[model samples]
Target: MEYISFYNGNEMPIVGLGTFRVENNDECKASVKHAIESGFTHIDTAMIYENEDKVGEGIAEGLAATGLKRSDLFITSKLWLADYGRENVAEAYETSLKKLGLDYLDLYLMHWPGTDEAVMIDTWQGMEDLYKENKVKNIGVSNFNVEHLEALLAQVSIKPVINQVEFHPYLLQASLNRYLDVQNIHMESWSPLMNAQILEDETVKAIAKEVGKSPAQVIIRWNIEHGVVVIPKSVTPSRIEENLEVFDFSLTAEQIERLDKLNENSRIGPDPVEYSGH
Candidate 1:
């Protein structure tokens, strides 16, 4: 698996399994197991997903099935909005650890920027505490815009290593990407396939035909070529295996540009700024 090194020198697989709405415990566990058995070493889950327990089960089974140890895997989870506070964030981290049946996480993130700036800053402080205590290897924020990042960076001592967000050909987020680049923050793409919407796009289809790859593979290759970590979710065994097969061929610069022009600032998930769910 290809890896991206964080600012602190920690590295993770460029591709991972995203567990967003895989809510059924049995299904979630089986999907994770299948992904691991198919050569996935990275797994992404969040407290809000409410599937950590099952994800943990899949990790245990996958380790046993593959004879791989826990240290060989890169596991990540997030702190939900409801857990935003100096004290509650740490507790939330512990709760995720317990649920995932792990001693420490490879990376942990604030799920969102919250409703205002003070809450985000306070929550970031809590994340900093986790980093200092060695509870997690790296810390970051998800769904943060440039404004939120600037405000957090102005107040915090340590910079976030990543800013996970919804990204795809449809939602290019070019300006945000540029800002993240200047800040030395890596971007991780969730919904990289636009929840299957991009698979049927004419441009994507033509590229897939030209490259002799699936449209999904073309989109994933685009993210990797642009230096973004991508986690595409799937529960089917065949698709779980297929998603990891983008290393063979690459998109040419011309092809990449065509894919780039497909951007319309579209989003398949909720907008972070307006989302008020706890």
Candidate 2:
């Protein structure tokens, strides 16, 4: 698996397993376990997902199956929008820790900017405190645009190391990438396959055929090659393995350019800036 070294001194796997709508307990646990067994060390979860306990259970099962220690994995979780605020941030972090049954998280992110301004700043400060306390290795924001990032950077003592956004071939954010690159903030992509939209594109399909790889694999490979971290969710065991099978081949510049033409500025997930009114 490819990796991105965040500015905050942590390395995140380029490809992780996203657990957004994976609601079933047994299936989520089994899929997470299968993903870990399939060479996925990065497991992304959220407090709002209401599956941290199951995610923890799956991780334990995977560790038992593989005999790997906690240090061998990079786990990430997000604080929900409703839980944003200084005091609640601490409470949320503790709650997530209790649910995950872990001493520390590899990374913790703000699920959204949240509604309350004081609460947002408070939560950010709390996250900074958590970082200083070494409760979390790194802190970040999700669904944040350039303006939102700039605003946070202006106020907070600790800058977010990464920004997880809804990036994919169909929703290419060149401007966002350029800005984040200038700030040395790494970008993580959610809904990486563009909700399987790229799979239906003629150019992507042709390229996938030429490369002897599936369309999903090609899109993921493209994202990694472009230095964007991605998390593709799947409950099927076979697809989980397939998602991890992207490291074998490299996308050529010409192929990447061809795929770049597929961008229509389509976003498969919520827009962070508008959603949070930031």
TM-scores of the models, in the given order? 0.98, 0.96
Off by over 4 Å in 1: none
Best by TM-score: 1
Please provide, for model 1 over 72-131, each residue's C-alpha lDDT reduced to its tens digit, 9 standing for 90 to 100: 999999998888888898899999999999999999999888778888898899999999
Quote the lDDT for 87 in model 1: 83
TM-score of 1: 0.98
Clashing pairs in 1: none
